[model samples]
Target: MADRVVAHQGAACWATLFTHAHYLPCLAVLLQSMRACQTRYPLVVMVTETVDARTRERLARMGCVLRDVDAWRVPHADGSLAFERFQNVWTKLRAFELYEYERVVMIDSDMLMCHNMDELFDLPLERGMIAAAFACTCNPKQIPTYPAEWTPRNCGYALRPHPPNDARQLTKPTYRLINSGVVVLEPSQEQQAEIHTFILRHTERVAQYRFPDQDLLADVYRDRIQMLPWYYNALKTLRQCHPDLWNDGEARIIHYILDKPWLLGPSPCGEHTHLHSLWWDAYASLAAHPATLSMTRDEWANEIALHVRGI
Candidate 1:
């Protein structure tokens, strides 16, 4: 793994977004997990201007290369008040604007890395093509808010690899939907502009983007994507909703799809109890680090009790 990572040295990096102050705690635990994995690649934390100077300083102290970016949200394009809440998520596409890094593995701040995933950097990522896991369109919540197409049968994972070989990488699925939770991106200014125009110009089309970045990205790059195995972006919901395709032991990273573990704390949890504890363990490890400067012990306890746990 170390030798493979060296091949992409100075050309690849890990990137994640932090929109505001509230998401800082989530980013802290994620960074802690990276430290545990001994990730050799630099992590570029893209932060919006909404984050204050204090939060920026804390991120710097955590050994992040901070890239200040403007907030990207176009609610008028969606034209629905109900979908307005997800408009902020469009900001995540800013990772594409980072043309400096040849290959950028962008992930959400809410996720936790279970082990060393530096191997993803070594994977082939051609121009105009991305590598990402297929979305488990199980529609577990059965919510009307989701698109009508989101069903188990329509999910990309439903397509079988004969003999159940998880090593097989499927590129073309009828659904062609890629989960943007964890994506291997080839940064390009031209690609960025094209996606931006596609979303803004196609107003009626963007209306169907119920999942914001996920919908828009999958649509724009559907034909030009390489679908990875489910383990890379293992959604927490799959444990029960799509258990046939899930194996927590094989999952390289856990995507906290519905509920974040940090917010759940040590309550009488049912759904993702062990997974929540996994995230808490990373937080605890971060708390004890000698170089830890972002959140003090008292501050962490207060945040969890008041803001997160709501005691």
Candidate 2:
């Protein structure tokens, strides 16, 4: 058994998130990571969009609190992708200011903690937001890779242009482009009201946009949010950024969101088309974890297969 030490002593709490059944692997990896860290935070809450009977039983056995919400219930006008399903969950999380904890770190279910993050809460959100990385192209050469819709002006990347001569630009981007994977939020009625208005306005326009939630989050909060250290939502995107990440260092979370762990370990990019094994490894790990409740490999295969069929 791993040593169990509460990183926050007695006054800290954090949340690991998921939606529908796609969260199984993320939940398993998250719990195992927390266990490895020996974090003794009072509660480990799993936010989901209705868990199946099997998952509910499994989470209960692990002694994790499960909050089931209706994804469909989230206010949506057109329901493009309903990505804001998460924002609705955040509404529930933000309500916890009434709780005794001083900070709440919300993590996406598609991420894993590679190291202990006991010190993250210590960094106050006094006048800023906390996040892992920025969205879209960072390097000059990588600019063409993203579609125009994902560029700075289009509600995908930061709302500002990249600086030409600034070498530190990637390290400290000028605009607010928070990857929703890992965020450390301090509860404030002011912040929550802003967030609520942002969500409400986007909810009304989902019928017109393709990527409504991602669009709103990037566009609305572009100037207001703050960028945290990169390692927080360390994306497994490409090689250029990988070498800097130290397994024993400050990086707290690994967000394998796009090239999701369900399909691949790290996203296969460029000439790596032959590396389907990366995807296989991710699927295998999820299948092998003993703590995983419900939704077996066959079921996941079928689920993804359905996605491919439509594609």
For each candidate, give its TM-score against the true structure. Answer: 0.87, 0.62
lDDT score of residue 78 within candidate 1: 35
- Pairs that collide in candidate 1 are none
Cα misplacement distance, residue 133 of candidate 2 (Å)? 2.9
| N/CA/C clash count, model 2 | 2
lDDT per residue as tens, model 2, 173-269? 2343446666666545666567566666666554443334344455655544556556666655522333333242555665654445344434444
TM-score of 2: 0.62
Count of backbone clashes, every candidate in sequence: 0, 2
lDDT of 1 by residue, 150-203 (tens): 787777777676112443344334357667889888788889988988977887
Question: What does the lDDT read for residue 80 in candidate 2?
Answer: 46
Off by over 4 Å in 2: 1-10, 46-49, 68-100, 127-132, 138-174, 188-190, 200-224, 238-251, 264-311
Candidate 1 residue runs with Cα over 4 Å from true position: 1-9, 76-84, 162-174, 288-290, 293-307
Question: In model 1, how large is the Cα lDDT of residue 206?
Answer: 80
